[model samples]
Target: MAGGFTTMKTLLYRLFVLAILLSPVYTSDHSAMCAEAATPQTAAQKQKAAAQAKKKKEADKKRAQKKKEQVKKQKAQQKAAAEKQEARAKQQEKAAKAQAQKQAQKQEEEEELKQAWLRQQAELNSSTPKKEVVSLINIGAKFGYAGIMDKMTNNYANISRPNELDNDYAYHSLKGGPGAGLSLTYELQYGAFRFETGFDFTYLNSTSAYEFSLMRRLEQPYGGNYFYITDDLRETRNAGYVGLPIMFGAQFSRYYFMAGAKVGYGLFGNYKQRGRYDIVVKDDALRDPYGLGIHDVPTLAKDQRKLSLQQPSVSLCAEVGIDLDEWLQAQPDKKNKKRTKPGERLPFGREHLHYKLGIFAEYGILNTNKPTGALPLSFNADDPYPQQTNSMLSIADTRVNNLFVGVKFAIQFEIPGKVARPIPAPASAAEISVFDKESMTSLTTAIVQVKNTGNNRTIMKPKTLSKGVIRQRAAVGEYVAMAKAKNYYPESVAFTVDSPGIVVPVKIYMQRRPVFQVKVTDKETGAALAAQVQITKRNDKETAYSMQTDSVNGLSEVMLQDSLQYALHIEQIGYEAVDTLISDIGDKMHISLTPIKKGEIFVMKNLFFATNKTRILSSSEEALEALFGYLERNPEIRIKIMGHTDNVGKDEANQRLSEGRANAVREDLIKRGIDETRIEAEGYGETLPVDTNDTEEGRQNNRRVEIEIL
Candidate 1:
């Protein structure tokens, strides 16, 4: 289009220039030649203009169509982008919601699992049946009397010379002496079963008596000689041994029994003997001739004998004992004393010390006597012939065993076991609080009892102070807390002491008991009437509470439990008595008593009867008694007993029932010491109903017995 426009402008410019040049050459005929030239050029220029205009129009139309297509394509791309973004956003929202739901479900499952675990732990803690096994080291001392059964036999052949001598010997009584021991034991205990092994040092002593006689002949210048000797010997023997004992036993409450074996090696032994002897000699050549001989001669005979105890001794040992720790130190004050701490040694404050008083026996299973052939007595004149004399044990031919039986007292210092140390468990602080459930206020006077559930032991029983809180230290375990106060129902709660050094809070809320306050007054004058008020549980004969209202105030108060019914009886001299069932107990009750006068009606509110019958039920005793007492106190007053019934049956039947019920009351009063003449019976049937017979309560009220004073 631009090139066509430029060509057209050049043609116009050349035509103008040719017209100017021809105007000068043909001035005379310029108009005629110009007109002809203009005509032809105009025709050609018009044709070119039409073509260019058509072409420009076509170009503009094409550009408009291309621009419209671009705009439509851009709008289409924008809509697709928007749709994609919306889809992505929706997907993100769905994923986020799913994730949130999954998280919530996971959290809920975790919570449920946690609650289940807590319940399981609580149940396990409450009913666990296994007792902990304990190991201990005990250092102890024991003292007792030790006696031995001695079996002795004399072998004269081993002690006497060839045929030149005569020998006689007898072994007499053997008596035991004191025995003392020290022990270090390791003990393992599981429930009632006990195992103990340790080292022990024991010392024992005994005394034995022996008698011997010897006669010998001597050759002399006077031809013959005779010698005779008799000796009594008492010997004391001492032995010390170091032993290892393997014991198995059981402990039952405060008593224990142990039976085991002790392997002991004799560390030392010694003996001493002292006594007197009588000696006489007769010679047939001189003394027989003179018919005289040496009489009794006393000579002191003393010697230290050698011990012949074997190297090693095995004994069967048994002990039956009561734990003296349960008795000797059973005093509460002693038990409450400060205990010795770990790694501490206190002379008297060791709480771990256990004492036992027992009867113990050790019978030697292996012969402890090792004898070398030697004479029990020495005839040599040399002062102390220690080598010639031997212990009676060495000369005895039979086996010798040791037996010790006596009361033994022992004090054992117990060392904490690796397992037992875990017990008497770690101490944790507990803060217990008591509050009134209704009022949400502290109960300062509440008594809080904390018990360890595992052991069923009461750990603390304390009355709350002004703060209504008690702070105490308790072992780490499950516990139950109970709170009680006067005029309040007791409350209990369960809690756990899980960690040491942290306070476990226990809150107990107690409900207050219902209180019954009664005021008695005269019906006419409203004057206070002193009355005897006796309250008993319904259907129970024993009085639940009894009190006398003062004449001045006519007030009596008693605290009673909820969800129970009581029978109330009130009586005053010269006034009608009241007997009623107290089921809906409120804060206060007012009673207006009518004086014993003519035509004053008193309803027996507590009286009960059998269904559809006139027979009085046993529950009506209180009402009958009240009426009887009122009649008795006002002896001169006569009473008329009237009965009424609800309209539930035929009129004739109702009338008869009422009449029978009234007569029944009269008879009961008569039997209870009221004069028959003083009581009259009448029936109103359904005509004199005190309340409507429309509802059950109204019907119940309509059926009643009333006493009329006359």
Candidate 2:
């Protein structure tokens, strides 16, 4: 039995070892099993063994629950770590993207800044200066014809002569010559006008051919001089002159006109003559019973000689031509662009490029007939030379008048600088309302006409209104609006649009207009003239109605407002434009227009100057504009502007001020496109007063400007 027990113990030990090796749970509970194995017991031990087995089973369950809890906690910790790593990676990626975007934006902004700087620099380089003084140098060459105008008649160099015997006769004919000149002109431009003070080295060669003859009866026959004898001489003479011209020129577009006086010095002259003479001799009274018998000895003497002429010559010069500056060509699209400066390089191999080509005519106002000395003729005195005895054969019949006509070419070079640009018309909008002023009601049936006064562009033609309001886009400029209705007299208003995109409203009052007829007649003659008649509101200078008189009758009829003050403006091409305030609209208004002739004076009442200053005022704009228009219409007419001042200041100061004021007006006219040569400015100061300067009213009259037609 002991042996059997030993075997079971061995087997149990082996089983315990196998369980420990095969089951990790059993190995972990080995301490509890060892404690149980060390205990010794009987039936209580058996019951304890059963209780222990139950406890062991409960411990295994508790351990398994703890292990499952630990495993779940570990898995949760691992998942949290993985999530945190993924979040870190995503954050790094987001930061990198933001940095790249920031760099890109910064680069773009820098590029824009660089471009803006470049543009700013370009603007600084390209912009022109304002109101710069321009210096111009002009050189030209010219050639033309010559003519002699003789004031003397009936003696020598006359075109008409009597056919009777013993009559003194002379004839003169002009032959043209070549002229060349080099001019250095220093010009100061005031607007479109230029005041030029220059020296011209002009060489002129003028040729005049003349014939003279005289016959007479001698008192006694002596030394073969029996009958009277004279020589019929044909002579050709050349006169050369060097002149200096002082001129004023005006430029309008490409065309320019200049008028001035040239003071010339006669440098040298020469003459050649050939003649036929009838020599009458007594011949000792051959075959005659008395001594009264004389022989007719006629001789044809053809002689040629050189003579000299002299004097200081004065001439009037005038030129009309076009400037061939490529920049001066009409380009409406590039009107606002920067103009080609004087020093700017031009294309087409052109240098010194301001070229002018035109026709010029000069006439000597002074008689160019001063003989330096006499030439002794080489003739046979023994044969009785009657032509040499008379003083008429020695430079007496020669008359010379300098005249020239030819093409002139000029090149102008200018200094580089800034200049004031032309002021353009202001941009504006028109808000037109057609309404009855007295009734304060909108006239839906009224027609409105809107026209731009600057360019004479028809902004809106006469259109019947529907709602009495119309919005039209227009440039900044002066405009005329006319409203017409059936019963209400047509009303017109001059409105100025001063701002861009802003609407300017014009109001015209309607009233019962009275029909008036105007009969235009010449002041000197009772004849009619073709004229344009404009009836305008006196205050605003707005044309209420415009009509043209019949060319034959010179009559225009229009409806006019009786209550409103009115002014009449009459314009004709050959007559001075008249602007007069109408005192009475009735009585078959007989308006007289004066013909614009040389020496006619027209007072410019509205030309304004600042106190002791030469600057033009804005208030005088309308008047100056009217003057400019008048000048434009009469392109051939020349005017002299004379300025006067009240005798309040010193004579010298007043003179300077008056002159400056006159020049200021001239400059303004030139700016408006009047040519410089067409106008001349002078100052009389207090020297020539129109009225007494003792009273303020008289002084106001004395302080005035006048324009004389020349």
Q: Against the true structure, whose lDDT is highest?
A: 1
**Best model number under TM-score:** 1
Per-model TM against the reference: 0.39, 0.33
lDDT of 1 at 615: 88
User: What C-alpha lDDT does candidate 2 achieve relative to the native structure?
Assistant: 0.66
Q: Model 2, 1-710: lDDT tens per residue?
A: 99999999999999988877889787769768877876655667899899999999999999999999999999999999989989999999999899999878755643543443444345445645222344567777787765544333343322222212233444555554677666777665554576665777666554544444332223333432233333444444455666778878887777888888888887665554445544344444454422333223233333433334446788898889987865552322323223322233222222223567889888887767754324223234333343442122244444556777788887766543432122122234677787677678888788888998888889998888787787666776799998898768788889887754355877667664556788887788877655678889988888898777765787878766668888888876446778877776654687787777888886785567778899888987656765776687568988988999999979999999889988988888889998899999999999998889999999999888888888
**Candidate 2 lowest-lDDT run of ten:** 156-165
Stretches of model 2 off by over 4 angstroms after superposition: 1-132, 148-166, 214-233, 275-310, 327-352, 372-381, 385-399, 419-710
- Model 2 lDDT, residue 511, Cα: 61
lDDT of 1 at 363: 81
